[model samples]
Each structure stands twice: as structure tokens, then as C-alpha cells.
Target: MPLKPGANPYKILHLEKGCTDKEIQKAYRAQCLKWHPDKNLDNKEEAERRFIEAKEAFDFLYDKEKREEYDNREERIRMAQEHHSKRMAEADGKRKKLIEDLEKREKEFSNGGKRSADGSTPMTAAQQAKKKKTDQRNFKEEIEAIRRQLEKEVNEEVKQKATLMKTEREKHQKSQEKLTPRLLLKWKTSEGLDYSEDDIRKLFSTFGIISHISSAIEKKDRRKRILEFESGANAWGAELETGNAPMPEITCEWLQPPVETVKKASDEPVKSTNTGANNLEHMSLDDLEAQIMGGF
Candidate 1:
């Protein structure tokens, strides 16, 4: 079976949860040495099992992606536990109320001689009291059964929600991983001002090889530019350096594209153009101007 959130990898490795990666590695190595089958010749089978368990724990904790998944699972488990606890408390309160009501009914019956609602005695008071007691017992039993069933359903729902959340998170992570390297460069320029293709190239040349530069469609007034880099690393580097010092007279910062934008970009068919300048030409002047002024 797959390891669930309740199964602590750290426990298997004999380390505390949230331990440093270095600590985990150290513990794993020690366990491997201690449980090596060759060293435990008298109990090779037990030693092998322990060794595999330790190795599996280490593998799950070592990977960044898997570790995140495990953390989410643990969080979901905690939430479910909290929900169960609260529901149980409510059930206990209801049980107490039912007991109180039964006692009150018994007092009323004693005072009123257990008469029927029509004001005529149905049986002797003792017989009527016994019947009431039986009814109360049956009611309590049914309530208990319902509470148990509700608890079971709630637990199942929580588990299902957790599974769904994990699946969606994995899907989102995959989509983010597949996102192309792109950077939005916001710049400010006076009205009617424009930068030539060569000039723009010269300005961003220090950053990285530019894949494409287009006016920001969203910020026409600001003369913002979206510069796509051949690599994300280069874009990140440029963003960092630009923040430290102004890129010439122009001020700019990097903007992360929205998920929708990234998805759209990923889906759009790539077109071949003869020249980099032609890429800008194919776009309307208004659109190009908007892209340029878009960044600040």
C-alpha cells in the first residue's frame, strides 16, 4: 500500500519530523549501516525488511515534489481529525439532551398518573412507565446508530476531499512546470515616445538572449514591454539585477504571467517569421504601442 500522511517517514528513519535534509541523510546512512543484511547474518530477513523501509522513507523525504505532496496529505489528515472531534462533541451533547428529556418525561408521567392525551388511562401507571422506558431506550439506540453512520460518512467525505485536492495540486504543478520561459518588463516613457528595435535590443542585450519583445497588450498607456527570454534563469537574473539598479533611464520590473496567460501561450500555435522585427510588424501598431507602454 502507498504510504499515507499518518505514516511518518521521519519515524521510520528514527529522526524527528521537520528535520533538516542533512539530518535525514545522516540518519538514513546510519540505518543502512546498522541494518545491512550481511551484518545481521542471524536475522537477515528482518534486517532486509528494516533496510528497505528506511530506504523508502528516505526516498520520499528527499524529493522536493514528493515532500510537498506528503505535507499536503498531513494537513488534510489533521483537518479531518479536527472535524471528527467536533462532530463527536456535538453527538455527546445531543445524547446528554436526550437523557435530560427522558428524565423530564418520567417526572411528568409520575405527577400526571401516566394518563393518555385523551385524559383516559390506557393501562396502570406501572405498565405505562415501563412502555415509556422501552420507547426511550429504542430511541436512544436509533440515535446512536445514526450518529455512528454520520461519523462514517463524514470521514469518507474528508478522505475524498483530500484525495481530490492532492490530484488537483499535482495537475497544477505539472502545468507550472510546462510553462514557457517568459518575462513581462514594465517601463515608463513620455507620451508619443518610442524605442526602435535596435535600441530596445541594445538596452536588454546585457540581460540575456531575447526570444521576442512585444508591447504589453494590457498596458498601452505605460509603454510596457513583454520580453520573452530563451531561459527562465536568464529572466530571473535580469529581474534581480534590474531591481538592484535602473536599466539606463528606464525603470522596469518583472511580472509573473497569470496562469490563464501561460496556458494560452502554451496552446497557441507557433508561427515562423523571417525576421525578429517582423514579429512586431505583424501585430497592429496600437497593440504594439500598448505592449510597450504596458510595463512600468
Candidate 2:
């Protein structure tokens, strides 16, 4: 008759039967922000718990009939509680009457006016020994019960400690493995020289370039560009030491100009025929072309 949960569940959310749909929805959202599955992915138990709470709230609020049923059930539970409380009070009164009767008997015995069936005090040694033995057995049984309970608790505690130590050992081993040395760089034919991925990227960054240095073997075009850039850079560095300008670099694009632009400028030589000769239409790089046309 009495309503009682054997243990506390420590729920993340609680909803009452009388709660409005809007109120329930608001509570669900507020709880999900902190206890959603995605938010607690690392804790499978916690994630499942929150998921279950959210689902329960949704199930109760989504259907009108189900909600009405839940309300009825809660009312029944409240009535049952009230009845149980009344029953407990009645039982307590009866128990008090029984205990009073027992006390009345105990007091009559303690008045020390009892006599044996033979109308004389008799020393029954065998009966007294048997009673003492029975008392000892009962005491021993109580001690054994306590010992078994202590043993069960000790075993459970040991298991918990073992599990925690295992987790800690795994974590420690992972850290040790990560600390071990790594081969950060290795030679690849297309890359030309051995350098770590970070170091190669650093070289690209130094030249104000933000390109990805992909696997040179898998990506041939990236490999060629890297080699060409490195080669040209090395050559220019050499000429700079001798106090002389670097050699002119060549490209396929420079050898061919846009025919339409060249034709447009060449045909419309309206003013400054010489100025039109060195127009951007005939050059790949305006700055380099300007320098060349200036005098050198």
C-alpha cells in the first residue's frame, strides 16, 4: 500500500504529472544543455541517463491520452499513500497495546513471587546448561552473520580498487608510449632532402608562401614546384655573394603572350609607338618587364 523506491536514482530531471507541456519542454531544454549525450560523450552511463530522462519527458508530454493516464496514476498513488499512513498509525496503536501487555507480564515476573510445579525451588542443572548452550549458539550465529557481511563489503571494495588501479595503469602506459622518440623525418625521392613535415612547412612560411607541402610521392606537381623554387632560390643566393644580379628566370608562360592584347596594342599605335612596345600585354610580370624596358 505504501509507495517507496528501494534506492534513490539521482535523476538528472524530474517532471510532475500536472506540469504543462510548455513547462516540461522548457525543463527538458535546460537540462539537455548540460546533460545531453553529445555533451557527455565520454561518460556512457551519464549520457544514457540524460537521454533516458529527456525521452521520458518527451513521451509523457507528446500524447494527451498518455498524459491523462499518468495523472490518474499519480492520483491513485497519492491516495494509496494516505491510506498507508492511516494503516501505519492503526498498526502502531495495536503494537503499543501488545507491548504494554508484555511489560505487564514482565513486571509480574520481576515481583519475585513465582514457584515451581512441585511447590519448591529446584536446581535443574541439565536444563540450565542446555539453555546456556542455546544462547551461545545464537550469539555465534549473530557473529557469523556480521563476519559474512564484512567479508562481502571487503570483497566489493577490493574489486573497486582493482578497477581504479587498472584504469590508472592504462593511462600511465599511454603517457609513457607518447613520450618515446619518433622518426619525424625520412628521405623521399621527390622531396629531394629529408626534413620533418613541420620543418618543410616552416621553410614555405619563411618565403611568405602558405601552400601545403603534400606527400611529394603521391602528388608530383607539388614536388616539382618545391624543387624548382628551392633550386632558383639557391642560385640567386649564390649570385648575391658575388655582388652581381641574379640570372633571369624563365617560364613557359613568359614565352607566350595573349595574342589579342598584343594585337590590340600593336594595331592601335595612336600615341607613343615606343611606349606601346613595352606594354603589360606583351609581359608576364609588369614590374620585371618595367625594369628591363627602363634601360638594362
TM per candidate comes to 0.44, 0.31
lDDT over C-alpha atoms for residue 30 of model 1: 94
**What would you estimate as the lDDT of candidate 1?**
0.59
Question: Taking the tens digit of each residue's C-alpha lDDT, what string does model 1 give over 130-233?
Answer: 87879788877978887887878787887887787778667745645443344445545444555555666676667667767774343444445566555333
Model 2 misplaced stretches (Cα beyond 4 Å): 1-12, 105-296
Q: Write the per-residue lDDT of candidate 2 for residues 1-296, one digit (tens) a residue.
A: 00011211113236554667677667666766767666787895776555555544453354455456445545755675576567556655655665565555444344354565567764355654565566556655655665576567557656765685566456534433332110011122332533444655553343323323333232332211121122112111211111112321211111111111112345841211111122122222333333433431
lDDT winner? 1
TM-score: model 1 vs. ground truth: 0.44
